[model samples]
Target chain A: LAKTTQPISMDSYEGQEVNITCSHNNIATNDYITWYQQFPSQGPRFIIQGYKTKVTNEVASLFIPADRKSSTLSLPRVSLSDTAVYYCLVGAFHSGGYQKVTFGIGTKLQVIP
Target chain B: SAVISQKPSRDICQRGTSLTIQCQVDSQVTMMFWYRQQPGQSLTLIATANQGSEATYESGFVIDKFPISRPNLTFSTLTVSNMSPEDSSIYLCSATGLAGQETQYFGPGTRLLVL
Candidate 1:
């Protein structure tokens, strides 16, 4: 099992750029690093997914190093709504086997006004 | 992205009773998953509901307790049988539409508070 470690909690202010990093040292070759944001009383929403380098979407940007040992999710100019638990998961998308996507203890980002 | 919906958005049930939560997807999906999340905790995979076969349960979960039904590609249900206070949690349903694109969209979870 590829285990992931991330900060337990973080604090930020509104309009601040918050970056949450996750370390998955034993990630597999076919695995992709994905992030999800979950708010209170709601299911998690997919934030971003990346294989290497950087992938930017309208919501956030995912940065994966060449070694792939870790990944970062950058939320630009976050607001109060961005206050949620962020999960980092590593999984094989098309490995032809059952991909048991494991989510780590997410980083709880509390964005203040 | 896929739109998903779950029925009985929330319910407070009595002990020893059972609650069946329905998950419906907007389109056909190859894989449907059921997860449980205790308040202030991360999500735990309860089982994987296959379209035509018995659902595959994860560790610490069983068919007799968390019975799941996947009748087709677009719908699945997870029943919490013989419920207890410990079973009170948020039950979320998710589905992956494509094979290689492993984006799993989630429904607005069904919150069950077993008293």
Candidate 2:
């Protein structure tokens, strides 16, 4: 399992774009960067994931540079309801027989209206 | 995607007592995971529940304190033994994706307040 680092907290106004970056300098070659959003009292939900370059979804976009040492999750036009803790995880693209994946202390994004 | 549900959404238990949190998935899953989220802390993986076998626990977690049971592919339970004030936190259950992907869907979580 790869360890990840992220901001402890961040604040963003409504209708603004928020980008949360995660650093995993020791990321493995076959590892993929995945992001999850967790609201209060709820489980973390998959936001976006990508190995490199950019990957966009209905909810968010993931950007990974060539180095793959870090990745960012971009949420567009944020709202108060979007206030949640976002987790960044580094793990193998494919687990051979289900490896134990860990989640780090994610960035608590507070979308202020 | 799978729909996961848990029992006793919130419970207040006395010290030295135990509480069993149940996790149920709509569809059969290959693996189910249990996690603990301490106050103002990140999530920690407790163990991986495999049907018909013992669960593999993490470094700090053990089967004695946090016993797990995977009766089948769609159901599992985690029991918090000898509850204490430190045990007051949210317990979540999740299921891994069908393929080897790291995607996991989580349950509503069981909030345990040890008094």
Candidate 3:
């Protein structure tokens, strides 16, 4: 699995767009970048994923750079409820299958009212 | 997305006691994983529960301390044995990772507080 790094915390206000960037410098060719959001006392939820370029969903959008060394999760029109820990995951496919995946200490986003 | 449910949402147990958490998925999934999250920490994979075989544990986790059972495709259980203060954390179950899609869905986690 590729190790990921992001800010420990970030602050924003309602009605603003927020972008959290994740760095995976040692990413492999077959790696896919995935993001998960975790709220207090709840499990992590899938946000978005991308192999390269860009991908968008109703909730968020993922932008992967050309080098695939980093990615960013963009949340449009943030709200106080959007405050949570966001995890960047690099999914590696090995032997034509899956491998042990781990989650790192994610970036904590605090949206103020 | 798969709908997942977990039994005993939260519990407070004494040391040396054990707590079992049950995870049920609405759809049959080939890969079920158990994870532990220490307070203010990230998740660590405890094991991968296979439907008809022994669960594959991750490094630093064992079948003795955290026993897992996967009897069918939709249900599984994780038991925290001989609990201590360090065992007080959230236990979560996830599925649908390796079945085909790259996404994984998680149950609402079981919060355990060992006293």
Candidate 4:
């Protein structure tokens, strides 16, 4: 498993774009970058995932540079509802073998209305 | 994506008591996982439940303390045995779409408070 480092907290205003970046210096070639959003009392929800470059979804976008050591989750036009903890995980996309994805201390995003 | 339902959405239990959280998936899944999330902390994998087999627990978790059962591919349960204040946390269950699928869909989570 690859360890990820991200900011403990971030503040953003409504309608603004929020970008949370995570550093995984030991990311493996077979590893994939994934992001999840968790709100109070609810389970974490998958936001976006990408192996390299940029991948956009209905909820968010993921940006991974060529280095593959870091990935950024970009939430566009944030709202108060988007104020939640965002987690970045690095692991194999295939779970058949003997690999497990572990989540680290996530970035807490507070969207100010 | 699969829909997962966890019973006992939230509960308050006395210390030394035990609670079993149930997870049911709409469709049959290949792998089921249980995780614990302490207050103000991140999620930690507790164990992986495989049908007709024993669960594989994490480093800090034990089968004696957090026993898990997988009766089939669509359902699983996690029991927090001999609960303590330290056992107060949100327990979440997740399931993989396929055998090789890494994308996990999580349940709403069960909040357990041991007093």
Judged by DockQ cut-offs, the docking class of candidate 2 is medium
Q: What fraction of correct interface contacts does each candidate retain?
A: 0.48, 0.64, 0.55, 0.55
- Candidate 2 vs candidate 3: which has greater lDDT? 3
Worst 10 residues of 4 chain B by lDDT: B96-105
Best by DockQ: 2
Interface RMSD (one decimal) of model 1 = 2.4
Taking the tens digit of each residue's C-alpha lDDT, what string does model 1 give over A52-72?
A: 999999999999999999999
True contacts kept of 3: 0.55
Give the TM-scores of the predictions, in the order they appear: 0.95, 0.94, 0.95, 0.95
Give the clashing residue pairs of candidate 3, or none: none
- Residue B1: error of model 4 in Å? 3.0
lDDT per residue for candidate 4 within A1-113, as digits (tens), equals: 99999999999999999999999999999998889889988888888889999999889889999999999999999999999999999998553543368999899999998
Task: Predict model 2's lDDT versus the native.
Answer: 0.88
TM-score of chain A of each: 0.94, 0.94, 0.93, 0.95
Expressed as tens digits, the lDDT of each residue in B56-90 for candidate 2 is: 89899989999999998899999999999999999
lDDT tens digits by residue: candidate 2, A1-113: 88999999999999999999999999998788888899987888888878899999999999999999999899999999999999999887444244356899999999888
Error of 2 at B59 (Å): 0.7
DockQ of every model listed? 0.56, 0.62, 0.58, 0.57
